[model samples]
Target: MNMTDSEKAAKVIEALKAAEGEPAQIALPILNGLVGLVQGGGEAPLEFEEARSGAFLAICEIGKALHRGQPADQLWAPAIAAAERWQALAR
Candidate 1:
């Protein structure tokens, strides 16, 4: 999908605002809250961790594609920029 810079920026801003509450505290908590349906423990055998990892990769890829102006579905670089930004502020 073709996303203009302004549109992407707006979306990011909206997301930031929406997550301005406790959601901003921990990325893991946000993911778990969003997609917690896959929860499982050792005996039950659930792929929650894998699912979380995949979601992280997908978001990072989307951010990368947006930043690089690449085809959104083709490939996405890791979201190091966003991670660093969040990490610094989160600390």
Candidate 2:
């Protein structure tokens, strides 16, 4: 589905309210929403955009590790850190 930047930002904010669990284990929709805010069409700052990519890479790493039967913990530290960094930059 296609959505404007405003629509994506709105979705991200709305989802954030309902995503009050482990930061590492955040809902995929939240991550999707975030990607919407940072993609090629997005106007996010370089730092924010980079942080978004880092968060995604961390998630992918966790998935790969899990597929290999290795223990994975949300890629918690890296993902959460990237989130915090981007959030700060966005502000």
Candidate 3:
């Protein structure tokens, strides 16, 4: 049975809630990979844009985890730091 995207996302969120240790360890590499694809600038600009959109969705999911009271230091510190650096670069 094929799950819809929302179902898949909900499953991932539930897994993250039950996860032990640093969730960032699992999440960051994926985010970094998406960012790399966006920044790499290959022939498939649309694919890169899709990757960038995925990265944004990942960031939102992380933020949702934070809002749901995941420990900031343990699960999300690196993500927060990376976001800060990105903001700094933008300014």
Candidate 4:
């Protein structure tokens, strides 16, 4: 079955949440709610740029958590590799 953009976005959010530690606790619930809204056929409150910015900020938080000895390397390392591959494709 094809997933909607919201579902894809939610998967990314979940991956970030798995890698993110304490710093992300506040934002994850809000993000998850937005995902739910999208899943339910409602518009997400954030615009595309806003969502992109938020995702970037969340990634940074995950990186910080990783730096602080959070045990998410197994989860995040492959993600980082995948990101690198996509970046390479864009180049």
Candidate 5:
């Protein structure tokens, strides 16, 4: 059976907690709240999937940057450049 989005988020939370560090500290609560949003039906303000993806992307990138001893802001440079290129391309 496929896991629900909340289930997936919970799994991520479990792993993050096991990893135990700044990423866990920062991301754990966000993922905890995300579980509710996933179950929140149509009443939630933001589309939970979009919020989930963006938050996960930031967490992964920030983790990578920190692991490499680079500033967390390092992700913005490539992300912005890629976004601009994607925007300019015909859909």
Candidate 6:
């Protein structure tokens, strides 16, 4: 089924929040959510890149949280770095 960007973002954010404080494996489902968003959109390659980078960041954040006992916001270094690169290239 198709979803608007806001819909997809909400779902993804929910999945991420639910996965918090759980095992690193909880991130796999979150990764799948990101993939779903990437798949539902139009033909814009930039969208795919942005979603992909976002997914990587999400996964990295979840993994780091599960491993290091850090908070979600604190675990976002990888995602932030990836987003910076992706945004730079998108410009």
- The 0-to-1 C-alpha lDDT of every candidate, in the order given, reads 0.37, 0.53, 0.43, 0.45, 0.44, 0.53
State how far residue 66 of model 2 sits from its true place (Å). 1.4
Task: List where candidate 1 sits over 4 angstroms from the true fold.
Answer: 1-46, 73-91
Per-candidate clashes, comma-separated: 0, 0, 0, 0, 0, 0
> TM-scores for all candidates?
0.32, 0.51, 0.31, 0.35, 0.42, 0.47
In candidate 5, where is summed lDDT lowest over 10 consecutive residues? 82-91
For model 6, give the 10-residue run with minimal summed lDDT.
80-89
Ranking by lDDT: 6, 2, 4, 5, 3, 1
The residue-by-residue lDDT of candidate 5 on 1-91, one tens digit each, is: 7665545555544444443344534644543443332332343334453455454564456456656666655554443333233223312
Candidates by TM-score, descending order: 2, 6, 5, 4, 1, 3
Query: After TM-score superposition, what is the CA distance of residue 77 in candidate 3 from its true location, in Å?
Result: 11
Candidate 4 achieves a global lDDT of 0.45
Candidate 5 achieves a global lDDT of 0.44
Better of 2 and 3 by TM-score: 2
**Residue-by-residue lDDT tens digits, candidate 2, 1-91:** 8865445434444444444343434544455445545454557667657866665576456545545656556454665565555555555
Is candidate 4 or 5 superior in TM-score?
5
Cα lDDT tens digits, model 3, 1-91, are 7543333334433343433244556654444433332232334345434543443454556655655656555434443443333333323
Query: Superposing all C-alpha atoms, what RMSD in Å does each candidate have to the true structure?
Result: 15.6, 5.5, 11.3, 11.8, 11.7, 6.0
lDDT (tens digit, per residue) of candidate 6 on 1-91: 7655545555555555665555656655555555555343345576556755565655656565656655665554454444444434444
